[model samples]
Target: MAATVTPENPRTSPTISRSVTHTVNGSHKFVIQGYSLAKGMGVGKHIASDLFAVGGYHWAIYFYPDGKNPEDNSTYVSVFIALANDGSDVRALFELTLVDQSGHGKHKVHSHFDRSLESGPYTLKYKGSMWGYKRFFRRSLLESSDFLKNDCLKINCTVGVVVSAIENLQLHSINVTESDIGSHFGALLDNMEGSDVTFNVAGEKFPAHKLVLAARSPEFRSKFFDGLDVEQQEIIVTDLDTKVFKALLHFIYRDTLTEEVDEVSSTTSSDFLISETLTAKLLAAADKYGLERLRMMCESRLCKDICVNSVSIILTLADSCHATELKSVCLKFAAENLAAVMMSEGFESMKENCPRLQSEILMTIAGCEVDSCSAGEKSQSVWAQLSDGGDDAE
Candidate 1:
């Protein structure tokens, strides 16, 4: 039997462990000629600076005219410094400075320096890893600020690669800092630094870190490692809408839907909110990406919005997205309120775009009528038999 420690007896041992870690620092200055012309080059598109050597590695800078995130909608300019050579598990710190063109000496700077962090230096898993900002500065603001002058802009990037080894040293039970990994990762995502992947959806581009995505979603892990090319930096996503793809990325990075952006509702014409349609699309994207929790979240929100005006549309989406719970709710709701649903604009759309859904709706109503045969079966049969026969709507 193992012995248990008592108040009178304590376990004690000599601690002599040491970690040898330090950073090799370097800086690169990049000048952009014709900064004015670089505007509107397209979202996710970049003006690349010449490669520079730093800390035994090669690095380069990228400037995005229309912002790096699709959801930002071209409202800001983006800048990021990236590792150019193939590497794995390279850890580092970075600082980016946007030079003030005027003599005011008020330059904009984003840095991970001279501050105590809950976590150590960030780790980059592979090449093409980047660090910077998706919205470094607002477009109109930057255009008018002292940073841009004479059609040129100057920027500086500093990299400090973290090195580590084992060494002999004294150790003690030191008090650790409070947990802040979420905020650290959140900072990484918002800072857009050390991102290694670019996902293009419908013309909008989003930059993200690969290991983060792979760790969060199994589907992403498979896409990155199992069969696909690991070094494929840019991925084109054609099926999902730009907004849908952005929300997916948000959930992948942070594990929650961000409340920063809002959309115009297609169904209600509401201003600045997460609309039902967007949620439904998000549910589909989440399912596709194998983000089950996010899918459930979207499905839950969509569940509360079901009504006669939206049931058919919701039902069709649920069917396609394979959201069994949401689909069951929608089908039952549609069958119980068949008259109101048929008169709805959503029902008409279902008839046109998804004839199988029309059949499914009819069949669901027929099933309900069968259970309630005493509630006039012949009359319900007339409506149930009205379903069109066609492609997979059922």
Candidate 2:
């Protein structure tokens, strides 16, 4: 059984014609029942009404008479569609879905359908239907007959079906504005949230592991985090935690935080000292993954808070791994404060243990000159010599 569209004016007959016109995205725009679904319309609740807008068309109708009763083997789905039409064209679109039944409720029956596309418009034709579908669809036409005063067709389908079909449909056109970036970002971000291997950082879910893996190579980062959540979506812009993570995550994403400072505050203390080893690991992992921002952070703590004492192990590890930036800072401190370093036995031992650092320090010490001559004595000596010369002349 096929559903049909009802005309507002009884004097005219119902007709649904579609035209595939070029839109912004280089694809066809399907004008179905005077309303458009862009291209690639999917079977879902959103387009239910539009699907039924064609004259003499019904939706979700299924007929299966296995030599049995009509009601037992026939079904129809309820759907409704409304179009904002202004005399000659449709301005907006909306749809409502009702139900899905495949005649035999005892055995779960699934119905598969397709949309037929042509040069101008598209047609959605269902393969199966029963008498119940015919009656249900016919009632929708009657209900929509007087909806609008414009003498156009009104669609009535049931509400609440999956809208998976129209999601990929795009228009044919050139999108050069930020709207293109924003829309694509929104869709990609939405898909990121849908993945399973992500984490809830603060409140937003992101691919925590993938972010760690993406460090070192930005190409790898882009590829690894390609389908993952973006900083803008999950990370709040104003919240301190989100802001901090945003800056850090971008570094992780792009591998470009070479000279950037990690904004640390009292809040950072909570995570590093009390919470999970995440902060520490992130720092080390950042260093390992070549995240300059994270490495700088570790370096800052290692330099400023010598009282932490345990940071030596980190410095040693970083130096052992040939963290050039970190090693330079450590070498500078040791060379400038050689006296204090020698007295502290720990730093002295560290210096002795590192041959490269020891060699650097020896070079710096050898080049430094210690002048013992006093300025006053040299002046007095010159005066005495002049006075002796005057006495000899007299």
Candidate 1 lDDT over 1-394, as tens digits, reads 9778887877776657678888999998888878878787888899888788877889998888889878854798889989999888888888889999898989999887654275567777788998788888888988888999898899989889987888766564477897777677777888889999888888777889989998988888998989565999999988887877777877876677867333333356231122345776788888788888888887787777676687777777887888888888888888777877788777887888877666566667566433344445443465545543323365
Question: lDDT scores for all predictions?
Answer: 0.78, 0.37
> What value of lDDT does candidate 2 attain over all alpha carbons?
0.37
Stretches off by above 4 angstroms in model 2 are: 1-283, 306-317, 348-355, 367-394
Cα RMSD of all models vs. native, in order, equals: 23.3, 33.1
Instruction: Indicate the TM-score of model 1.
Output: 0.45
State TM-scores per candidate.
Answer: 0.45, 0.27
Clashes of each: 7, 35
Q: Output the number of the lDDT-best candidate.
A: 1
- Candidate number of the best TM-score: 1
Cα-based lDDT at residue 17, candidate 2 = 40
Residue runs of model 1 more than 4 Å from their true location after superposition: 1-181, 201-205, 260-276, 366-394
Query: Model 2: what TM-score?
Result: 0.27
